[model samples]
Target chain A: MNHLDEKDIRKLTEETVKQLGSSATPELVENVVKEAIDRIQYKAGSHVIDTSPLKKAALQQSGNRIIVTAFGKNRVGILAGLTGILARHKCNILDLTQKLLQEFFTIMILVDINESPVDFDTIKTDVTRVGEELDLKVVIQHEEIFNAMHRV
Target chain B: MPIAIEEILETIRMTEVEHFDIRTVTMGISLKDCCSDDLNKLKKNIYEKIMRVAAEHVMVAKKIESDYGISIANKRIAVTPISLIADAYHKEDFIEIAQTLDKAAHELGIDFLGGFSALVQKGATPGEQNMMHAVPDALASTQHICSSVNVATTKAGINMDAVKLMGEVIKQTAQLTGDKDAIGCAKLVVFANVPEDNPFIAGAFHGVSEPDVVINVGISGPGVILRTIREIPDTLDISTLSDHIRRMAFKITRAGEYLGKKVAEMQNVQFGIVDISLAPTPVPGDSVADILKAIGLEDVGAAGTTAALALLNDSVKRGGMMASSYVGGMSGAFIPVSEDEGMIRAAERGNISIEKLEAMTSVCSVGLDMIAIPGKTSAEIISGIIADECAIGISNNKTTAVRIIPVPGKDVGESVNYGGLLGMAPIMGCSQLSNNIFINRGGRFPAPVKGINN
Candidate 1:
């Protein structure tokens, strides 16, 4: 059975015919048919809100998750130096993003310290010291605060 | 899935630009076991017990902040009301206990330690009276100690004797700490039906029913709420405005619940309530009065101020009640004149008066908080003010407090700056007429008929 329901398949088939006219026979149009199936499958699967409690439980059980942020004049090796210290401390970088506007550079890293052997205090101290050494402003905070302020 | 980049930036922007942060993480420690006939033993016991919790509470709070990239503004402690804890002591003079608490707080790096308190709603005990007497010297002598006296409760009615005493205590506190803009009085709050788990300073204390140790979170975000309203179309009326506020409050409260419970577990203490009050800071853009203004009031004490406060208070409670199961403390919109920008501006412009503030407090979270009054204001008038606030709390069967500091040398229009969370407040003088005869009639104000719903 196809991953998509009958209505989607019918609409997709009609589009295929409209695009290729008589050349869109099922046997000759294998590539188009496969493409349609894949598209339908992806649409059906994507954007489903994860309502599972297990995911939430796992997230919290992973001990501490913090955001490491650095702001400074755009300079080379900022990310490399920061991540190098994090890697040495065995911290897992879960997510990161950066923006460079004129001479200013800003970066935020979401890190999981549950896997890291270092305590939360030492990780913060080291990250802060390293960032300062590179002449960057740094701050660390927990993840739940963001979830609280933004998500209802 | 994962938190969106927009959400991350929004959080950072709130802390960086809007002054969004946790106002306080107050650990309510019970001093029930620290009682002794010997003052030295009592002090030693308190020192040890407080030492065990203070460093650890601050450590965990700092750790949580680092892991979250948010700041915990104040790390504090609120032990069991000093009067109750000192009941076993033979001495009526409890100043030593207050000094000990102040010392412990300083050594622990805690900002303020509440519970220099006496609950005399029904009547004052000899010991409680002595503790109350020590309030002025304690407040004058100590930096970290916060004092309070519950002069009324809905069930027990208002204790006029204690009210009369507090008038004198406030004046003495003002006189003693006159050099510091009467900062001593800022550290003392007079209350009716005060909450046990309030994490905010000047009024926080561990109630008798609370656990041995617990962490209560007061989540602050007046700026965030204001930003939410501004982002929407201006044509939106009160109904939709309330809906938006309620939703935002729910999310803000959830964050507090998550943090409070997790931090409590990590610290091996019982998790306390999440106070969902939109606590305004002195910092611009973070005032609860600004929230009222964004809700379409000309200012916090405008014509529709009380109605606006009622709406904001009710909406916040509706959202916060659903977000956390244990929503306790002063969970509404706070409108302290000094602490709120809109309030300070309105007050300074003479657009808001003491009468208007009193009326608004009937609807807001706390009552007449951080209000600076004239230094020469009589103790009778101070008692009169306390009586009025207590009446509101008793009649409504809700919590209300009076934290009026009569800055010793500053009269009306002249402001006082206590700095930090204790913001600058212009002096709002009270009625010059005497309320001495009424206040001197020392007796309980009987509880209202509505006080007995249960």
Candidate 2:
């Protein structure tokens, strides 16, 4: 009962087709079917689903997520220096983006540190030291603040 | 990215360059249960209660500040007004309790501990009167303790007797701390319709109805708003500019609410409201006056200053209401002459006067805040000023207060530098015009018609 079988997938697909009607396409059908199955599994396991975006963001809070931003005068070794520290600390870089504005280089990384052996303060100190060596402005803040300010 | 690059950069800029930070994370601990008939026992109960409950407040606030990479400027504590719990004691006993509170605050590593206060909007009991009388010594002898007396409210009108007493109290406090240019007066506030959960000092106190312990936060970011207004085109209309301010206020309020709740959770206390006051520091670009100037004023006391401040205050409240479920306290722009560099400059340049500041106060969060007058400005005139401010508060149905300092032996040209967050101000003069006869007729100023809306 915890998992969906073949008949359940067939039934969910039929319901998705009915809901879409004239707007249905192969891509839409496939996406809707996948979403339906995921929802069923999620509800079966968790017993509750968050509908409000603000509450969803709050409920997603944990020790795993953080945001790291670094910006300075464009330099060659900035990325390698930062990434090297993260790799050593076992900090998983979930998403990264870098851009250049005139003479400055701006980089932002979303990191997961739940698997790391070091605590938050130690990681922050290491990152700050590397930033000082490279002469860049770096800050690491918990992800909750960002979600609270911008998501809603 | 889960959070957009523009959003991330905006938050960083607000914190790093724009001077955005949490002004205070004040823990309001109820001490109603600490009351006793014996003065010694009462003092012990009050001291023990504060020390035990707020032991982790500073540590937790520091942790949260680091967690978010945003600075929390002051960690503070407020308690149930001492008069309510220790009314059985004498003025000297209250003074001793103030010392005890000061000691606990020092040990807890907090900047200021508030609630050596009394609420006498209509009248005062013997205990409340004693607490009021102890104001001078309590403030003069203690560094970390703050006190406030509410002499007026919308529904009950102004307590002229209490108002007159506070005038004398302010003078005595000034004289006692005269060596530091009347620094003691800076820690005392006279209020009308004071809020129960105000997280700002020197007016914060836990109200009787509040829970055992709760956390309230006041957010500070006048520089961010000023920069946002500067980026806007000068040709834009006032309404459009107001929308921009409202949006910015929403974001800041959300951040404050989140931080306050987390701090409360860490201490296992109930979360209180977010006070969306744009409190300013002496930093060059972080003045509320600069925001007013960015709104097209020639200077702070220019012709349309009042109108501009009204728009700024109203838009901030509107945006804050939409962002948080619980929004209270004085949620508007604070225009303290000593604390804001632009306001201090305007006073030094003689572009702003006390009368103009009073007019501006009718539309802002606080009234006549941190204004320093000359030494010999008579107590009757101070009473008169307090009465006029209370009248504005009563008729307008809003919170208003006076934190005036009559700096001893100082004239208009000299400025007293208290340094740090207290800032500095040129001694502003008040009219010596005699209101002696009117103030001498000391009685309750009747409630205004606006107070009878219900």
Candidate 3:
């Protein structure tokens, strides 16, 4: 399994020979190599994974913030369209995460609107009425809510 | 971290789904300086004073609302009681000043203007008698003006004469506005130990102790507290439950204080106090009776309701008092019937009665609020109710008030609708048993001597 890192390749190669000793045919060896490479490629925390995509600070920042949370049936263009509107409003995306499971799409984005120059009412109106614009249930909230609830 | 995304979502959910919001931002403007022997000059002076101090109230409030994310339910104004400043005015001339206040409030886009009021707990002076006589006319003439009469206090005892007069005033006011569900009565309140800095109408007023101009905020959070109690495990004890409520109150009071301070700072006015009253609305899911029911009562007026309310009120005060620096006003749960959907349902179901409500008031905040009785109910019976409530406040040294509306021509089981937050309520039955002989005796009920230790 050349695709597997030396650590996993060595462990898998040793396990294959030990588990299938004496009856370890060429066909079995080839199958083991293929399965090991497949598992290594699909598993979490892959050795060659590009982690820059997961690190938030790489693209996001924090400040005078509002959180945009949206939920709807999983469909194409949900993330892109919502982000596109935020972009158009001059709101900088501080952090964003989206997940689609069982035909349900839930997304949350932390945004900084200080640089936008647009009034808070416009942003608030856009967020609360996002269902009309994009067929999604959306809520916009200020960060003070969390501070009041969780912290002293 | 200062706050988490989850916490922000929780507060948003509370506002969006549970009906939590700031009850009011009342600007208390002292009218003591406008007192003059010339009635016309006094009226003009009062109007200009209110306008000068309140011109930017609505605009500034809306701006602060946008700056913060929370919504302010009402922008109201409270002024010094007119009786203190109307010593020279004739009884019949008081309507002109009431109309002037209405004009000023309407111009400022203020919803309620309080303090067309008199304090005669000790004795009614000529000025106080004039203001008291003008109650019905003042309320009947103005849409925004709210009037209150303080007829009792712990230190001064109950003024039975003023109490008797108010009963007639209420009846006359109801008769004048009989076509509109007697809404004039809804705008009037009778109080014992009324708080000067209360931001809640119709008992709000700027007392002599307060500054010239001040900002007071009242927080609404019965729904928020109810939601928190529901989240707790049922196996918990009263102490544990109280702790949970106190924590929630802390957060709610913090929000109110933050908003109040911001508005006061922006307006260059002194910040008065945060009234942590759990005011309910007619909207669904925003009732104090619902909280009582959730605390293990079959109905709001059932046995053990007062105990549960006491626990809730004590905990809310404990937490809210800790959150704000200067906590004042009616800082407890108010059981206003028409304004609370659950209380309305309980009353209609025959589970809640006037007597039980009186019992609840002993442990609750305001007394007999937003209640409606039959049109045929006599003024003496209303006076008896007010007298009983005053006795409770005087003995306990607590604030109590009565804001009952006797709808003209309405009978029991029929409902009266005042619309908006004033809400609709089934006409409650009062006792046919009259106390006219006792109430007719014009003398003060002496203050209870509470000096056992001395």
Tens-digit lDDT track of model 3 for B257-300? 88888789989999999999999999888999999988888989
The digit string of per-residue lDDT tens for model 2 on A1-152 reads 44554456668789999999999998898888877666765777845542322223323435577889999998879989998999899997766889999999999988888889999999999998998799999999998899888867
Q: Tens-digit lDDT track for model 1 on B99-197?
A: 888889988888899999888999977788888888899898898999989999999999999999999999999999999989998899999988878
How far is B449's C-alpha from truth in model 2 (Å)?
Answer: 1.8
Give the lowest summed-lDDT range of ten residues in model 2 chain B: B35-44
Candidate 3 local lDDT, residue A2: 18
Query: In candidate 2, how many clashes are counted?
Result: 0
**Scored by Cα lDDT, where does model 3 land?**
0.85
| Each model's DockQ score | 0.35, 0.35, 0.18
Total clashing residue pairs per candidate? 7, 0, 0
- Let me know the TM-score candidate 2 reaches against the reference structure: 0.91
Q: Which candidate wins on lDDT?
A: 2
Clashing pairs in 3: none
Q: What is the interface RMSD of each candidate, in Å?
A: 3.6, 3.8, 4.8
Report how far residue B103 has shifted in candidate 1, in Å: 1.0
TM-score of chain A of each: 0.62, 0.61, 0.55
Q: Can you give the lDDT of residue A84 in candidate 3?
A: 80
